[model samples]
Target: MRQRPVNLMDNPHADRVKRVAQLAGRSAVRNRRQQFLAEGPQSATEAIRAHLGFLKLSEPAQQMWPVGETVAEVYYTQRLIISHPDLFALVQQLPAHVFVAETSDQVLQAMSDAVVHQGIVAVVNMPPHSLQPSPGAELVAGIVRVQDPGNVGTIIRVADASGADYALATAGTVDIYNPKAVRSTAGSLFHLPVYTRVELGTFVASFQGRIFAADGYGTRVLDQTDSGMLNGPTAWLFGNEGQGLNDDELRLADQRVAVPLYGLAESLNVATAATICLYSSAMAQRRQDPSTS
Candidate 1:
């Protein structure tokens, strides 16, 4: 006989519901709690997988896990449990520390920042900021003071797709955990290591490889830069959307590389520029060392 699932929460105003909703709007709350909301089916699914993967690690490995326990709680509407039984099954695999609850549609809506809640949300723990990339990391994508949450998230996704070893959000960049940013990641948040609130100068000082600044006015155009330069470990730094990299910031990079523009468009979006620069480095690196591809 199949056991029926019960709705564990029905009140939209419940304390638990409000706590989850607060994570969406308040950075202070998120920082103090060290948790953020992963809303909608995709984010929830990826988070669940990350949590389960963590459980499979050996004890010592678990203790050293780069991204801490990925999910702390999961809330889903009855409609979702019925429509997404597979997702529900994955939720059931979560450990005892993870709170799993079934909520009414209204309750789920109250807990989500999305206009359409998608019937699911997961409270995910933030990864520790202490794990710096190894000196051998092949590629990294860094954003400095990029204000748009969507652009930040999209750049993270593009970095993941291009096989960058890590994504970095320097101080003043929009919160990567912002609901819009999380949604824009389309689950890539769980795919790669994303370090936030990094210090640009500190990172530049510690990084062993070349740092390429994505500048609109640079001596070296990206397409014409020496392929050998792109073949090694590299970090691409992108700046704020409107101003790009300021003079002082550009001085830190080993090279300033511009994406050649054919059309009359004045500039490329930060995320778009990041995609081009990252893929260029990724393809070049893979071509040089096929084993990494």
Candidate 2:
């Protein structure tokens, strides 16, 4: 029998409500439940799109999925009507199995960690992608111990927009799934393949593509980068926010390329620097084949 939309407003302390809310704070809850809360309309839209193959890397993690469990669910506040037409329209396109529940404002707050809720949250059924590179993936981004979650999320967005094949985050980098990080992504989290908790040195050693380390004080300026170097597969390495890439890490890359600072600015934001680096590789790759460009 098909299920009907349920109204859940009475008990704010119900086990389900409490459990879902805990997802924002506890990684243990997310792992055990195999469901993470995507609070607000932006995350909801992206989480739904992930169901539609926005998450290409997730497919390989399906072995951990329980049997007969293709269905997913979404919850929202019926009383708290939002004027976001685009968000609602995206929700409507999802399959019928994604249940929508009507809840009160108090309940919505309990289910979200954000200071403000957009009256909607989607319970995304997602699996953790392993740190394996896809075949024929040329352009890759490597992130070191960038502790800031917002920077981590925004870098993923930069990778997605710059046509990077995938992103590999080494150990010590912030967890991509952390609620604050997820919120900062603004849906770019679901757009590209992201593999986390990797060993930077080990991965760099085996990478067949040219590795361009992003160093502000490096010898070669980005504009001076050779066209031939960009034509081949490439990997861009990014270091932490405070201390940049260590000596050992820098030695692993094929070349250390810096983005020239014309003005008096001391440095570029990690995400902004990464955006420029990724796009540089992307543009060069496209120039190698302009018909498709």
Candidate 3:
């Protein structure tokens, strides 16, 4: 005999439900369990799609899904109401490794990091990050200490859109996999490769080409700098959100280039500055080798 899927609507306080909810606020639990919650439909969907190396089974959803040897499970609450139309069809087509659960809206809210969860939450395994330079990488993004989850997620989205090779989120940066940050990514988290907790100086020293720092008051402006400098393999270093890059970090860069500001606005935000810098380099690289595009 086989086990049938159970509908969970009234058991918000169940041991299993509480365990999944722990991933939302507790890093220690996440670390111990080696998993983080991917809240909402877009993130939950992509969490299954990305095939992020290893996944563990949630005891509840295990019988219906979590089929593979390593076993991957995704918990979906209120989505059980409408997922049958599309999301369910999508997951059905995916490998049996993907497991889903149908639960109450209350359970989804409980598992979410936010007050409003968009009716889905997934506990996804965190992949191990390796920080080596991207092979044949044209442009790279390096993030250090910048603490805002939204900024970090947006910067990654920009880097992906601008066609940067890869990104390194240094030690002090907020958790890239945090539920709020994952929501901010809006699916780009699966599109881009983001390596975490890298050391700034060691990475810069080993990089094959020039490294540039985006600074507010630097000796060179984006347009003033030679286009040739942007053509080669490059790394762009962005620093702490408020204080900006420290002296030691700036010294690691081959150059510090500032984006021109004509408006009354005091300065540029890190994500905006990073987008401009990455686009400038990407366009320059495209010009250098038209066929590369």
The predicted structure with the larger lDDT, 1 or 2, is 1
Query: TM-score of every model?
Result: 0.92, 0.86, 0.86
The residue-by-residue lDDT of candidate 2 on 123-174, one tens digit each, is 7665554546554566888888888889998888888788787788887887
lDDT of 3 by residue, 1-293 (tens): 11223665557888788988888775567767877777777776666555532233323223212333222566555455475445554444445445656677777677678878676666676655543444446788888888888988888888777877677888888888777777877766655567777888778877888899999978899988788888899999988889999998999988989999888988999989998999999899898897977
Off by over 4 Å in 2: 1-4, 52-71, 79-82, 89-99, 129-131
Query: How well does candidate 1 match the true structure in TM-score terms?
Result: 0.92
Off by over 4 Å in 1: 1-5, 54-68
Clashes of 1: 0
lDDT of 1 at 52: 76
- Alpha-carbon lDDT of model 2: 0.75
Residue 165 of candidate 3: its Cα lDDT? 66
- The parts of candidate 3 lying over 4 Å away from their true place are 1-5, 52-71, 78-84, 94-97, 130-136
Query: Looking at model 3, which ten-residue stretch has the lowest summed lDDT?
Result: 57-66
Which has the greatest lDDT?
Answer: 1
Give residue 218's lDDT in candidate 3 (0 to 100): 88
RMSD (CA, Å), candidate 1 to true, equals: 2.9
